[model samples]
Target: MAARRKAPAARARRRSAALAVGLGVAPAAVVVLLAACLPSTPPQAAEPAGPPLPPVSSRWAVAPPPAVAVAGANPSRAAAVDLVDGAWADEVAAATGIPRRAVIAYAAADLTVAHEQPSCDIAWNTLAGIGWVESRHGSYGGATLTKRGLVAPRILGPRLTGDGVAAIEDTDGGALDGDDQWDRAVGPLQFIPETWHRWGADGDADGVRDPNNIDDAALAAARYLCRSGPLGTERAWRDAVFTYNPLTRYINDVATRANEYAQRVELG
Candidate 1:
């Protein structure tokens, strides 16, 4: 067999994957999983309902306590309206013409999990900025995030075969993206199987931790970015975003997009 190739800095962290350099997407938003990171200690196997997330600490500078997990999406469960007092999700949706549930869930997840990543202060727009660049809020190629947050027809990245892209062998046995020859980035957030395996989150409480779901993907991205350090500052944010795709251009693009989203939120 030929020698195992290494992915660029964009894929794996050289443990070793070069990871998601480009997914044939637009210039600024190069949505992709940075290869995959190894999972912390496996979480406890137990069913959880719509329980409140744990408190984040102000001390952690690297990775959550290896115990931070997100609840999966549940169609039956209503999204929290705590962003604003007495504003129903539908009310917000009708007023803003935005996906109310999606906005709230992303915001809630960001605020909730930031506890685990005390240093990381990711905003919902930061994620929306990523989503916009990645799949146009799950509208890429006519794909959409359903009421339950599943991106239909599934968004996948090009195969990492070392031909101008990183050469990642079939790691998950074609489980996540189903390529069989190599792993592909799946879902609106475009998480690679290896990375998802280590950091996949269940944002909806629906039992299965599906990355194709925006809620899950957003939360997983949050945890991954925060796992390193705080994102409240420019330097810190760049470093965190760089972990997703270790390219200076990619990080800069994400920063620009994220700032745009933040401004829109403030103005809107």
Candidate 2:
């Protein structure tokens, strides 16, 4: 789940901008100067701003409780993901700082997992925690998530060239990450090429197991977490999250966010 750090490139670009400023160029003129170097794409719709994310802290001693009560699964629902009540999703999305569309996907994914693997006890907020950490619910890098749960200008993590990440050579041959030299994490849940191959799912029943689609990615992440075994207890929950990403900070971050979402939903 970890990828190359973006700080280095960001720092390098800042230094370059400073040098241009020293060369008798106004700071505002840098944008015009760098126009040719920037990606040329259609203007994206503005992403909604939510409350600031709560700071990371340990909640691993206890797993977060469910955000809402789910009546198991409904066979009359068109899809497993439709188990989430729409009105409840809207309220929780606003209270928890997740986009509405993302709330639907995350809640639906958890519901789907509940139907398929109820023993896992995966909660929607836990999936929301991962979604926030992974790609801000598919709104990272100025990208926009459409009503259909499709993220435009697809989210891609830095290439895993071993600088500070695992040195993975190209596995998808540019098919998913568009890089033949090395593999990069893809989608909102940040699944690597190999992991996506193993756990990808079609949450929206669109017939395509696309990682770029939030519905698909969220379900894939749910299934991946469920595969780690039952999360009915604290240790099991921590182990499942750590298995998703080994870093202690990552586990804490997810726990903190998930807990906050649960609290927010309760208050709402």
Candidate 3:
């Protein structure tokens, strides 16, 4: 009867011991299971970048090309020659056998005095006519004098006179005496020595004032016009031409010729 009474206490003690063992082992098992089931996180991905640009070239920034000089006959000379319906150009071509283009080039080189001047046509016409009257457009015996007696040496060709004596007979009569004097008249323009000395400009870039050369003559005439004041003006221009050759007829003739040449060029 005594043994039966202690059985319940022993059974309760056994059950409590079993519960304690289970609780202690349960926490360690849960921690191990969690570690095995969970996956590791990968490293964060970097952002994508854009492509690089190309470098600029130095040659692309270089300057433009320089301007070239104009070709063809001189506008002024063309105007002048064209004024007489191509009379002056035809005459020059016939006399020297030089092409019209060459004559125009010569005229441009001669008449261009300053950067800012009137049309070369005026100078060309005046000069062409004067040359015709003076040297017959370079057709005169190469060396001779004007109406006024003066010694004009032939610069382009052989000397007409030797030892200060006339060789070629004076077709215009004994207008120019055989004095061999260096009168004012010079070049194809027949510029007086005194006048040329004062206002004689280097029409051509020949380092000297040569009135015999048509190119020089044209330039001198242009310079004279510039000195006279504005172009297309009657009084001022007329006065200037008179100064060159103290004659009204000469001025009128030059003006007429220049106007004619201007018309021709304008038409063309």
Question: How many pairs of residues collide in each model?
Answer: 24, 0, 12
| Most lDDT-accurate candidate | 2
Candidate 3 lDDT over 72-177, as tens digits, reads: 3343444322222234344444544433532442344322532335331133334444444444444455554432212245422222232232133222232222
* Runs with alpha carbons beyond 4 Å of true place in candidate 2: 1-77
Best by TM-score: 2
lDDT of 2 by residue, 63-140 (tens): 333333234445235675565656666677777778988888877776666667766767677777777777777877
Q: For every model shown, what is its TM-score relative to the native structure?
A: 0.68, 0.73, 0.44
lDDT per model vs. reference = 0.53, 0.60, 0.34
**Candidate 3 local accuracy as lDDT?**
0.34
Q: Which 10-residue window in model 2 sums to the lowest lDDT?
A: 10-19
Whole-model lDDT for model 1 versus the true structure?
0.53
Predictions: Cα RMSD each: 14.4, 15.3, 52.1
After TM-score superposition, what is the CA distance of residue 226 in candidate 3 from its true location, in Å?
1.9
Global fold similarity of model 2 (TM-score): 0.73
Candidate ranking under lDDT, highest first, comes to 2, 1, 3
Query: Looking at model 1, which ten-residue stretch has the lowest summed lDDT?
Result: 7-16
